[model samples]
Target: MVPPLVLDIDGTMTRPDDSVDPRFFDVLPQWDAPVVIATGKSFPYPVSLCHFMHIEQNVIAENGGVVLSGEQVTTNGDGEAARRVAEEYVAAGHDIGWGQTDLTNRWRETEIAVARDQPLGPLEELAAEHGLEVVDTGFAYHVKSPRIEKGLGLKSLAPLLDRTPEEFAAVGDSENDVSTFGVAGESYAVANADAKAQRAADVVLEESYSEGTLSVLEDLRERA
Candidate 1:
């Protein structure tokens, strides 16, 4: 049986132009399950990805701090916990990207058509400089506003479907993805995954980005 899929768009599926492999969409529709996007993107940014991928499913954003469906956003995070994490990042001295930024400004700055790319950082130094928590997956360092992780966000979603974290499969590459991988039954990363992420993955794609994701899809199909 095809299992539900959770994908990270930036490093996993696209380069920077919001372009994803058509084959991915082609095969994706065949899988009879929801595809949740767990990313740092906020507001209208992720909605565009859903349109591009032809997906009308649930999404987890802010590295799992925010959950969105249709036009509604939900919070499964602890209020004090979120506040404390944000305070820590600030105290550490890194520029934290949180909530919704001006989508137009983000696009103008990054040249990407989506608002998700607005969160920027040279993560390792940013973290080291400020003693902040940086989730490094290898490709880029996302400036996390709250220490709340994507894995936790995805885990909170279990109650919505009555499924366990082990039933889902997460695919990504980056420090932000580490927690997500831990939350999946069959976690995977691309060839470019950082050492920590790679170690946690059940499979590592030989190819990077879209190629790598498809490879894992093939393997999962076979195993299924």
Candidate 2:
């Protein structure tokens, strides 16, 4: 039987511009189970990926701030709070990118995206002041609710798929993905993953990005 899988997009499947390696798709047909993408990207971003990959599974987006399956969208974080924080950052003369400054942020709900290069210490302090949370996805900094987490989001969708977290295999490469690892029966990280992500994973693949993802899928298929 094919194992269910959850994938991260930024460092795990694509480069900064969201460009995926064609070889990844060439090997996609080999897996026979649902492939759900769990990412910190805006809602539209993951939706496009699902469409491109021809995946019918639900996608967890905005760092578990939202879950989209078909036409239904379930949101767990506070979009209003996210927006407020973004405005506050700008008023304080912080150079951050969001809906007001970056069109991509307009499609995002539940979290505001800030450039990764921006100082996070101030953001964390700012979030704490407002009873919010800050998370780094290697690609950007997300300001969201403290309760939102990828593992919880993935587990919430299990009933829809008729499977549990223990039945899924997850692969990711960032601090934001650590929660995802906690719930998957099989978890893996690319060689380029940070030490925290690598430690949280059950296995660390030899390759990076989509190559590591392909390796994980092949190994899981063999074991199955």
Q: Could you tell me every candidate's TM-score relative to the true structure?
A: 0.70, 0.93
lDDT of 1 by residue, 107-161 (tens): 2211111123324343434444544454443332343434567788777775576
lDDT of 2 by residue, 94-161 (tens): 86854355965878878888988777888888888888988877778888887898898888887678
Measured on C-alpha atoms, candidate 1 has an lDDT of 0.64
RMSD of each: 6.3, 1.8
Off by over 4 Å in 1: 15-18, 69-72, 76-132, 136-141
**RMSD value for candidate 1:** 6.3
Q: What 10-residue stretch in candidate 1 is worst by lDDT?
A: 107-116
Query: How many residue pairs in model 2 have overlapping backbones?
Result: 0
Determine which window of 10 residues in candidate 2 has minimal summed lDDT. 22-31
